[model samples]
Target: MNKSLLKLTFTFVALLFGLNTFAQDDFQGKAYYMSKTTMDMDQWGGREMSPDQKKRIEERMKSFLEKEYILTFNKSESIYKEDEKLEAPGSGRGWGGFASSFTGGPKYKNVKDQELLQDQEFFGKQFLIKDALKPLEWKMGTETKQIGQYTCFKATATKVVDEFDWRSMRRRQPPPKKKDSSETGDSAKADSDDPMNEIEVPKTIEVVAWYTPQIPINQGPDDYWGLPGLILEVNADRTTILCTKIVMNPEEKEDIDKPKKGDEVTQAEYNDIVTKKMTEMREMYSGRGRRN
Candidate 1:
């Protein structure tokens, strides 16, 4: 090659590298998401309740069912958290307390490093769940839709539901009636009295996600990620998380750092811990009921 041509090629490559670095350093975005989950009232004994009772139950559950979250992202890192707001008086009673105990706090993801760090406060104990990012095998489709000013493409995946994920939990169906008396032993009666035996979670759930190439960041709310673009909407089983607003390169940027203030544990280990604690509570409640 001629000397001039070689020099020009080198210059072009250097310019490209510099521009990529600059873009990574200066690019930041904040995505606001509104999440809502629908529950089958009949499955939760709502059918037995009066109309007024059902309405009150729904009102209390609204705090958990409908929520807003913020996802702040830069090139390879992102932090997702619920948007904090004051609860109405008496909204945090009964089931709210149980839900809050199992709910996780801010979650931080490092896409480049393939790391996930989440803060979870189960009951009164705090745990830092440090684990590899769970990759979803997404089947991308040619379908397209417009979300605000951005065009989004469709993708779907089947996710194995976590054992302790309450979002997929449902009341266990009763066993079929047995004509013989042998099936209704004392052991079976004891099991029926334990409330914990009534709850069950699905093994897997189908997730449909909508991602936009305009953002060009592989990030999403909750545990959803690994797309070619930023995910704008997610339909996972009973829950829907939709992006409501986007702020690009905002002047005030929040730090995307891993949570450090908790006993470190892997995702599986944390699940086990929660499971053990729940079992203990269940046993205690059963003992008290037997005593009465």
Candidate 2:
């Protein structure tokens, strides 16, 4: 072959080889999640409300409880977020409203590094919570279930959590017990301890998850992860997050960037900061109401 023709042929062959290699190492994938939150609003006046009123409340709550999320992940890292208002079929940015403040935020997890970065917003303040991934002592089970054509295995874990335990926070103040002559030192010491303090401590929450080894990725939505495979369903504290769809290696892979712009704090620190600010706001509004 002539020199010019040989050069052209070599370039074409190289391009084909590059494309073939790209096809082999797929790497990137996206998982769509839909979260369902079942609320028992008894303390919030659910018991007093009529059936019609309850139905109307439930209808209004559909938008808040049923949320769509997308997790774009590779071998070691993944970004999980809520679907934007007008996101295309598979694309979404998970920044949500006030409801999300009490639950979660846009999280980026690197399983290999055991690191997590979350973009959290409370009221109007933005927070970038950087923390180690929450550890779960997952007990893998032998049971199997089908989740969207994928065979998934059951796993259970117990987590110490306080975020969703509203019942403990609402325990009726115990009535004063008459002091007995025999009940002096230890019993008095117990009474001196505040009941609210005990309830405020974190309690153990059971987490049930189903994962599929077919995907060969250690990833899941929110703080639930560290499984042997990709998690398809998670039931935690009366909330369920299910993976509805999965797409691998799209035509154009979008860049997954770490969130940077916000007040940097650990997950616990952020929660404390938010809780303090909210308490202050509530006290301020209550004061205004009294004056009015």
Candidate 3:
């Protein structure tokens, strides 16, 4: 072959080999992330619950959350999927009392936690930002860590609220109820009560995510993503999901396919469910407290 032809032939061979290597590389395409969580009862406002109660609550929470997630990425597309399951608010005396009052005055009593658990189901979805691949401002952080043999980087995010998130809601600020003249003295004392003022100061939450570049897959336990590597530690909302095991590029290449067309709920909708339930719960507790 002539010099130029030989050069072209060499280049073509190199390209073919590079493409083959890329296709077979364990860390190149898609990955799966899973974790087991042991949320602290006190951390989640279940401080009043006994250890056994907390254990039951945790089991229910974990079972509801137990899911398989798939992440897919290539030069052209990216996608995600959560194995679907039915979920409902877990039940206990506290949750039951709250639900009973809010749904109307005691249509039910001593409801089994299992029966209550069937009322709802919530999960995350595939997020397709127009340019999800073109990197944005995200740092896996400076903290060095190891999840299994893979060394990881840390990342953090923060949120702050000066007032209750629902303070601006019209329904939240109800017109003062008219007090009967016969109960004026007691009503006057009740009117002076302020429950909002009793809330403990919101504590600052810092999340430290451990990502391993070895994995080369930007994925995490939930909606968290866009890190330089697979996230091994996820701390948010006072709850943490740590990766106890991470196996990269196993002998058998597992296919990770993204959910197609209508498999999961939007993040906004999920937020609404949680907000509504929490509001209902608060209202239930509020009505049970005797006016001072």
Predicted structure with the largest TM-score when compared to the true one: 1
Give candidate 2 misplaced runs (Cα > 4 Å): 1-26, 86-96, 162-202, 285-292
> What pairs collide in candidate 1?
none
| Per-prediction TM-score | 0.90, 0.74, 0.44
Q: What is the C-alpha RMSD of each candidate to the true structure, in Å?
A: 7.1, 12.2, 14.0
Rank the models by lDDT, top first: 1, 2, 3
RMSD of 3: 14.0
lDDT of 3 by residue, 1-292 (tens): 7865664454456445535544643443444545333434574457788889877877655543334444443322234444344456553344433332222110101111111000123223222111112222454345565566656666676534223222111112334676655556545444434344234434333456766655544445444556655666676554456665443345565453332333234334545556686566555555565532
User: Which 10 residues in a row give candidate 1 its minimum summed lDDT?
Assistant: 10-19
**Ten-residue region with minimum lDDT total, candidate 3:** 109-118
Whole-model Cα lDDT per candidate?
A: 0.86, 0.73, 0.44
Any runs in candidate 3 off by more than 4 Å, and if so which? 1-32, 36-62, 65-140, 159-204, 244-292
Candidate 3's displacement at residue 248, Å, is 5.8
The per-residue C-alpha lDDT of model 2 at residue 122 equals 70
